[model samples]
Target chain A: MKRNLAQVVLSTVALLIVLSAFLPDTDGGFSGIVKSADSYFPIWFSIIAVFAFVLGASSLIGSHVRKIKDRETDWQYSVVTVLSFAIVLIVGLAKLGGASGLEGDVSDPASVLGRIFSSVLSPLHATLFSLLAFYMASAAFRSFRIRSLETTVLLVSASIIIIGRLPFASKLFSFLPDALQWLRPDKLSLWMLLVPNTAGQRAVLITVSLGVIAVALKYILGMSRDMFGGQK
Target chain B: MSSDSLLLLITLVVIAAAMLRHRDRKSEVDCIPEIEVAVRKAAELNRPAYFIPGSRDIDNIQTISALSMLKVVARYCAEYDVELIIPVSKSMVMERAREVCNAAYEEAGFSDRWSSSQVSYTTDDPLGFVAHVDGMIARAKPAVCFMFGFFAGESLLLAESSYNVAEVTIAGTAVPSQIPFFVASCDTTLIGEEFFAASAMLSGNQEDIAMLQGLDAGKQLAIGIILAVVVLSYLTLIFKPEMYESFLTIVDNLLHGGGR
Candidate 1:
């Protein structure tokens, strides 16, 4: 009974908050609550979220240490994890290479931490991101096969976008009129991005909103055991 | 707002109410069947489940949706003491997943069982992350597997690895391109919007369903308004292009008024 009552109250409050997302602000209905909730929740969530970082690092260390203790195979991976973690942690926390005069905060641009981040960490991150091109190229080669009607459509779309986005494609199609040129790879790419992509994206967004509301409702109503580790 | 706009809103609201009323307790499955069973079985098996928070940055909506679904899944794991392994390809995402999972455990009153080690950050390499996740799956040998979130080629690699290991998989996301691999490999799959709807449908709350119903209402309203405009414009084009000119006039007037 108590659980049910609590569920009802929580659900009501949650529904109101979600309701605020849609309620027209011009009417001043639930907009004030929405504004205040938005303002406050981020700060609160952020505070709680910081703990997660600590917990995550600790957990990472704990797991790696366990592997070392247990002599788990691929223990070297754990070593790399710990070493990399320690390097980043120490560089940032110890204020290494900090200015001799004002030598406390390591976040200082000239500090050792900053230098390492700028020269090493930043590049490493970017280098990792650049791998997407390689992965994408590989994925394209493999998945962009002419298999079926749908696959053919995908292949065509992919070709159009790839060709249109590249300068070489534009030059290839440069013989056409201005309007045709606009439909060149570059322009077609933009049109694809703006038209079909946006339309699909918008539809997805609406569906997502509904999903969020549904999940929230399930959580509140206690009908869904996925939240509680049970069956409906 | 014009009378037309007001009418649109009214129509949307009415449709939303109807859809909400019509919503059933069970999910609406279009393609894959037994997804709920797979998800539950994965949870009930009391083993570590792997989560890939997509191979994209935090700005990706698919990643956000994946995390949201993770929230629900994490809560279940917490309640059941099921272990979860989230192999992430982004540092920021690794950080966010930790928070989300922690909150899930906290909410479930299983904070004591919540260990950071359970959700560790793998390298940002997509293939590397896939390898790490696959390794974890092998080591832990999860009973049921869920591959939700933004993914690319790595998705197939992950799913294929799971299938090779004979793990039951349920996958969902909006990326149409990856749907085939998931369909082939996963036990049950949620396509496109259904992936987004999983959290809500799984929740089974009336108000939440009502909101989803409301979205359908909004979509119907959009369709109707579009149809009306097209028909009206077509007729004007045929009979009186001059009358059709007033349509642009109203738009211009609205634009001018809004600017003021």
Candidate 2:
């Protein structure tokens, strides 16, 4: 009974919001209420997100603390996690360094929070991002292995694009005859990206959009009970 | 009503019709080999399975689809009495994931095996979350890892890390740019709409199958319209070039609220 009530309420709200999005803004009466709801929904989400942050912080701290208590493998690392988390939380909330009070900006360059973000967090983020380059190389190596026709095609296309984008590609291709000039790596690469790549991407995009519409309809209609932890 | 609104209404009507038609029908989604392989490997190895329902929060549709897949995965794990670890970047997702997993286990008659601690909240910072997960992957060395949802640059990093440790890594995402990375690194990759379809397929719910049918019908309708427009455009260009400008105007007005 409770699940039925929740489903009805959720479905009604979802339908109203979806209708409001398509309804003309000039419409008055019920449309006005829905339009107001549609506008305020993001703010509601933001409020919820703020509360979720606290939940997230507590979960993180609780997990790490448990690890330390259990003396799990590499439990020592939890000490750094807890310490960093506490220091950042205290510094940010207390408005430490240049920002001495609640009114002061925590983002000020002179503030400890700002320095931590810029000096510590920024570099750490960069270091992690840089790992992508190596990962990409390894991934490419695996993908480009010429075991199948598909992989061979992928390799050839990738090679063309890589060479085509080079600064000396035009000069490199100048020796080719005029009849086969269209095969120039630079032109071929541009065509591959602008035409085939775009067409494929659009095809995928359209299909995905249709799938999204189906999923949205399922949710709005309360057909997806499992999502709500209700019995199918 | 606007054309776009009319189109949406038509779509809804078509989907409703399909749902009604399939209401009493039992439909089955084809087996996704990767899901089976991952589950079997985990059960065999006697190691926990790890699932990342994307880096996003529960609000995103992709994450919701990922959760649906998680329901199936959790059910399989529970039936096999294997543990499943889900580390989420968002607390809301953690909550939803726990509920989904708990429900799955209960449904599988393994409620005693379900625990909220299976789904934990990590940092929300994308890379920080990835770092934490990478560490978990290294330490736990799960038998199989399922990465499904919307992802960014972290997709490759996470997939590769899991690939290195886990016997099987199955990934699905609608992000075009990240699909290649998953394809390269993971044992199985579901690309584009396949990810969404896979979730629906795995659930094997009549409504979901009906929805898939409706989507196909809609796609067919769209293709017909596009083909008609293309043919019309060519005919006009060849036989009635002067009418082309008016044709463009009419199409523009029909598509957008142009000439209003």
Candidate 3:
């Protein structure tokens, strides 16, 4: 009985949103009424999302607290977690770093929170994100193995891309034949990306888009709800 | 949408439903079994199983699909007494993840063993969430890792790091851009539509399986429709240029939000 009610609610909301897509907005009347269903619902969804942020924060807090109580390995990190949360919460709420003391925006560049974020958080974020390059290089080493025919093709394609896309490649590889002048690394690489890569991605995109529609239909009809941890 | 696109959608949906009711199709996706193996491995080792739903909020359907897979993993973990850790980007998803795991455990008669803390929200920032999960990967050293959903930016970095740490890492995403990275780094990778298939296949429910078949039917119908449209459109343009021009204008208005 409960599950059936849930299904009815789910289907109704989904159908309403889907209908709103076809309804055009017009000045005051049924169109306005229909269009607002599409427009206003997102605001409500966003509000729910904002509330969920609290639930997420509390879950993080509870887990960290358990880590502290259990003295789990790396429990000390939990202290850092708790402290950071408290500091960020207090500083932002009180606007401690604001130029106008508590009166100014917490995000004002001159404010303490802003300066701390600028000086500390931003660089830390940059450094971590930068590590991705090294990680990618490593993963590429494993991925670019020349064992199979497919891998060999991939290696050749990647090599052409790397050489072509790099600056000063034309200068370095300037000894090419006149007939092969169009084989400039950049031009060839661009052709490879624009042609094959785009074609392949587009093909997949077409397939995936259709799949999304079907999967969405299944969801709206409540056929796949059981997979989402709900009982039939 | 334009009339043609709407026609395509309706055609595909009808075809898919017909296929489901009539066809006996089966999934040939390689990663599906690999995911099963990973779950069983985690059970044997009694190590934690980490499921990263995505870096997106619950508003994203990929995140919801990830939850479906999480239910499968949670049930296996409950059955085998393996630890299941689900780290999501949104708090709302965290709530759903907890409910899924708790329900799975209850069904398995292991409700006492299920902890809501197992599903957590690390951070709202994409890379920040990646950093926390990376930390968990290093410290907990989970036996298996399941990376599934719509990933961007940090997908490769997480895949590489997970590849280095876990005994089995199976990654699936419908995003074409990320599929290559997953294929290269993970032990098993489900590319594009295969990730969608995983959702239906994991359940082993006949209706879900039928939907999977339906998706294929839709794809086939779309191909035929596109081919016929292209031929008819060009033939019209060649034989009746003025009519073709008018048709193009009509299509443009219908498709480009100008008709309103």
B-chain TM-score, every candidate? Answer: 0.69, 0.90, 0.82
Question: Model 2 clash pairs?
Answer: none
Clashes of 3: 5
The CAPRI class of candidate 2 is: medium
Q: What order do you get sorting by lDDT, best first?
A: 2, 3, 1
Candidate 2 displacement at residue A90 in angstroms: 0.9
Native contacts conserved, per model: 0.16, 0.73, 0.70
Pairs with backbone N, CA or C atoms under 3 Å apart (clashes), candidate 1: A164-A185, A164-A186, A165-A185, A213-B208, A214-B200, A215-B200, A217-B205, A218-B203, A218-B205
TM-score for each predicted model, relative to the true structure: 0.64, 0.94, 0.88
Best by DockQ: 2
Q: Write the per-residue lDDT of candidate 2 for residues B28-134, one digit (tens) a residue.
A: 66867778777888999999899999998887989999999999999999988888999999989988898899888988999999888889887889999999999
lDDT of 1 by residue, A43-154 (tens): 7656765665565466567889999889899898889878977987877766677754354776778977788767876786565556446554554555577777866888
Collision pairs in model 3: A97-A111, A97-A112, A164-A185, A164-A186, B16-B214
**TM-score value, chain A, candidate 1:** 0.71
